[model samples]
Target: MNFVKRAGMSLRARKSRTAALLGIFVVICALLLGGFLLRSAAEGREAAAQRAIGVDVTVRKKGMSAADAGRLGALDVVHRYNPRFPVRAGADGFAALTSRRPAPGGARAGGGGPLAVVGVRDAGLLLPFSYGSTGITSGRGITPADAGRHVAMVEERLAAENGLKVGDTLRVRSTAGTRTVPVEIVGIFADPTRDPTGAAPPHELPGNVLYVPVRTARQLGSPGTTGEAVYRVGSPDQAERLHAAADTLLGAGSFDFRVNDKAYRDQVRPIQRVGAFASLIVLVIAVAGALVLGLLVMSQIRERRDELGVLLSLGERKWKLVGQHAVEVAALALPAVAVAAVAGQLAGPAAGAALPGGGSQHRRAAAADGVDATVPPPDPRVEPADVARVAGVGLGISLVATVVPGIGILRLHPRSILADTE
Candidate 1:
């Protein structure tokens, strides 16, 4: 009979032994598949977090003139540039408001103060609104049409305190009280910030915050008061490119550029640690699988010593005998590997979901940075590539485990093998 036929007959005759090896392979393949899927999922989450956090550069300095703003805005690396003008402004109705409680040193109540008045090019795309830390609760946000006009978006609490509503005109006085602008309330937004830490005066609380058009802010404040210019780069990778371009265009020492990616970094650290641990698990599983399967194959060879001796006596080539053993093991392991692939697909998502801190830490960090915490995280699913990788590893494991022990057949002398069996 051909070596292939004889190998098939041997496997058939040793039904219990073949079944035992198949069971071991099924367990090994399942572990390998699970580890690969988890590592891939963790990496996927890290990328998603980075994309969500976005990349931006803030230039903080005095004397960032309109010409500098125009130059930075015109850079190829800038997706959008928001030139901010922040001033302290007291609204007409809320000036008398004071915190309900007095301070520790008998300081006046918190309520009577000027709030931060921020002027922006686009109220909708401002960092706080864009990230969802603050959302419009009534009416609409400021638009380009509102530029140069005394339009504003007030916090919901502030509006309630002043009996203000959309379309109501708010009288805002600059910090110096030198000029007062009548800003029509175009919108009211919900503030995500909690109550003021006792450290902040009442006027500095979330209720006092307001958003106005940049032109109007310029009109109310000093003629040349310029705040930070924030440039949004498309990705973290492009942050440095934009910074360099801005530095060259604005002159080396004109201003300082700083990248804000702390939120992304904080969110990704835990996921990366999880991925590293998953990788270690994969390595251990592969090594242990090889050793366990190798020993099993070796024991099977010992039990079939008499049969192998008979075949060698019949002039069967040692290589052909090894090939026959390999085919039998591969045939058994292939089916188990296929089943493991299916099992992994079903189990991968559940395992990834169970991974601790995948979403919670990210949400907390996002909330701290005024990012919307309600956005759902990416779901973990086993992709086709994951299946292919698991299958390849499983087959390699099977070959190494079976072929290494099958080589022992070469050293067995036909006469000695038959005599030892006897």
Candidate 2:
């Protein structure tokens, strides 16, 4: 109690020094709280995107001709063993049905609905064409064996809205003609983006969509939908060169076609920019934090020179003086860190919500959609594990900041402090 009282009196006597130290703590706490939340949120968002799409590149046949493939194959950066294939709108010849359906006014009349069809010859090459959420979730993705016949994978959102499920049957109709076939629901999906929405009963299709073998797309979506090629380039910088080469091979006549590296470019650009910024911010904060702490400790030592001298003259060991100061600083810093950690937890969600690219909303919506929804993905949320990690990180940062200043104080000599006594 006596020791505590003396320490309190000493702190009161050196109000200016104590206040300066507290100010440093405040700045450190604020900066760390903000920075950690930003870093964690950005990391989480990136991880989610990456998990959703593992493919480095997605190639679509928006603008490819037969000749384009020759040039694409010739690109220097094109990886060997790279796969490519054809994708096209559905055609009657390719729209063979594998399921049975009822006639009008039959029991399962509601089960029969329009299908969004695409024809791909080689499922292996089109690995990027996988499933993600729309407004609803989905069961297993499409497999290579699921090809052929009129087997269908309907989006879960469309399925729920229409009360359709796997093993059900649908009547796929071609808009250009009266061609219709029965397709088995091998899989049900929940893709609102690709399906329907709003006052239209959600399952209504504005027009018919069909998927047949790629050779038949010319008769379906666009008459001009001819052969398109994709070449995987080693780097984004190679996109221009690859584009030029593809144009040369396809001939100037088909130059009206658009070559889009936008998806690939957009994907990589943000990652590079974010990585650079994160590194810069962390580096600057760490260095500045250390320097501020060092200077603050040195300044405090200077201000307490007389106190240090009296301690030494009264037989207090130099190391003991150092230890006492260290203990007091630690006591103050631990509380500051604990408070800051709580502040970080409270701020994390808000920061995550405000994070760019609609991160927070996506997570929140996914959560609200819940497992009860047909299409289900694990909810993106800050778990207790995340909070614990953030707490550890905050305390770690505070520890470093506290230790950095002590480096200067540790360099002081007993003789230098004692000289003030004489």
Candidate 3:
């Protein structure tokens, strides 16, 4: 029989040893596959987290204008921006919510208690809207396209108080009463905050606020200016470009640009740790797996000394004897790798679950980014390339295991083997 055939027959005849070897290889491949899947998932989650909560650079100055915001927003380093100009305005057709506690110093509020008009290029870019603390209950938010339009997004409670809905128009007068701004309602949002205690003014009440286009606020006595310009950038490093650009545009010492990466840091750090741990697992498993297989192969070779002597004495080439053992080990590796690939789908989730923290913080951070997520993040999954990687590693381990033991026994002659058998 050919050496390959003899190896197959030998494996078939020794069913228990073959099963044991198959089990060992299966375990090794499974562990390696799990590590690869985990690492890939961690990297993917980290990228998503970064996108969700990227760095924000806030620009504030003594007197900033929308024109300044436009120039800075056009920079390549800036992703999105909102220039806020919150000003007080008197409204018709609705009552602004006021605290029952008397107005501070008892100076009566004018025009049914004036409401705050927050002028912005985009309403959704506001911090309250970005965080889940406030959400649009109906219609859509004011976008950049609504910059010069007279559109407004009111609080849901204020909308309910006036029975107002989208498409309804409200008449607003400037605090100075010099300009009258007509705005059509576009959205209604839900806010959890209520009027505070201790004689707060009506305009200071949480519900007595509406979002309008910057042009509307400008028309209603606002300066079309902002203390801070909210900017979204991909990374903290990208903020440096924004800083230099702002310094050139607004002039150094005229404005301050501060980068806030708290959300990105909070969410991405844990995933990075998990990714590092996964790499460690792959390295340790690969090294320890080779060592274990080498020892096992050596023990099996020692037990088969008599068989080896007979094969050598019967005119079998010494290299064939070594090749037979190599073939047996190699055959076990293929099936073991195939089994691990199939089993990886079932095992991947458990491995991901074993990760510390388990995505609760990630979910909360995503929620704060305006996503009302109901389900948890996806679990780790084995990819096709991961199977290929584990297969290659398993084969390499088999080669090391077989070649080392075969070389050791091949150095001894058949006469020495028979002498040992006696």
Candidate 4:
């Protein structure tokens, strides 16, 4: 019989051994499927986080030390800055005044409340972008033109609660000193979560925040120190090198900073642990499965010592015998790998659905500043289509797993089988 026919016959004759080897191949394919899915999911989550933060790096004071925070503002790469101050309620503090129309009998108006204030030197840099849900909800954003105009931008919530609107005037008193400034509400916005990091989001109809130019904020005696140094890199990969260079130039611990790279920070220790553990486990599993498969195939070869002897005596070359066995294993293992890959793909969506806030019916509009601390929606990470691509890769791994053992079969000299005289 020809080499092809001989290979087919060998596969058919050793049903039990072939089945055992196929089982091992199945396990290896499964490991690859799981690892790829998790890896894709993690990448998606980090991408979402970066989008929300807007900038690639953030430098803040390590603690509540405003002095240290201000020092960061002096860095060469520092592009923007904000200084926070306290806004309180009193004669010179934040005050709300209500007006009662002219009545023959009486009229009344008043305002008072504790308030939190943030001071900014560069309003343009403070809100680099306009971030809001459904576009600008009210008046225009804060600008340098309003620097000394005593103008303020108020979120929708703050406006409604205080019965204030665009063109309305309110008082902001300084907590440190008895200084009050009357500022007009130039704009109303809608971000419930307003992050001090940057422009706040306007997801909710009314945001609970307010803004004023740096000049007006400083007048309130809440002049905070400068600010931490910050940077915006082009890509995540660039973050690491840039951070290292920055440290070299700025000096370690001189300023507090944050970079988006997965390495360098201990905060991502859990994710690192998971990835490291997964890699180690996958490696061990792959090798163990391959060994089990090799053993089964080797055992089958031993059992067919007599059959192999006859084939060798008939002038069959060593490569021909090795090729025949390899083809048989490929036929079984390749299909198993394909099936596993498809299954993994299909299962990915279901897994994503199980993630936290996954498939949430309510879409929360994110602010430009608030970081996306949660993982990204899982479906985008590993779609069903990815399964086919991964399966193809798994097939290559499976092929290598199977073919490697066949080398031993090739090394066997025909003389050895004939020496047995079977």
The number of the candidate with the highest lDDT is 3
Q: Score candidate 4 by lDDT.
A: 0.54
* lDDT (Cα, tens digit) per residue for candidate 2, span 1-422: 23345555666777877676666665565555566556656666555443332222333354554334444655675531122332222223233221233333443323323344554433323323322233213344333344445555555544554576777776655435445556666654333343232223212342232223333332233333333333445455555565565456655445443333333333334544564565566567656765666566557767788776676667666556555554454445555555666666666667655544454444343234221112222233445554454345444544565465545545666577776455
| Residue 135 CA displacement from its true place in model 4, Å | 20
lDDT of 4 by residue, 292-361 (tens): 6656656667777776777777888867766676667667766776667766767777544533333332
- Candidate 2 deviant stretches above 4 angstroms: 1-20, 51-149, 152-182, 185-261, 359-422
lDDT for position 112 in model 3: 32
Clashes of 4: 7
Output the TM-score of candidate 4: 0.56
RMSD of 3: 4.7
lDDT of 4 at 398: 46
CA shift of 248, model 3, Å: 6.4
Residue 272's lDDT in candidate 1: 76
Off by over 4 Å in 4: 1-5, 12-20, 50-151, 155-162, 166-210, 213-267, 349-374, 380-422
| lDDT (C-alpha, whole model) for all candidates | 0.75, 0.47, 0.81, 0.54
Using TM-score as the measure, the top candidate is 3
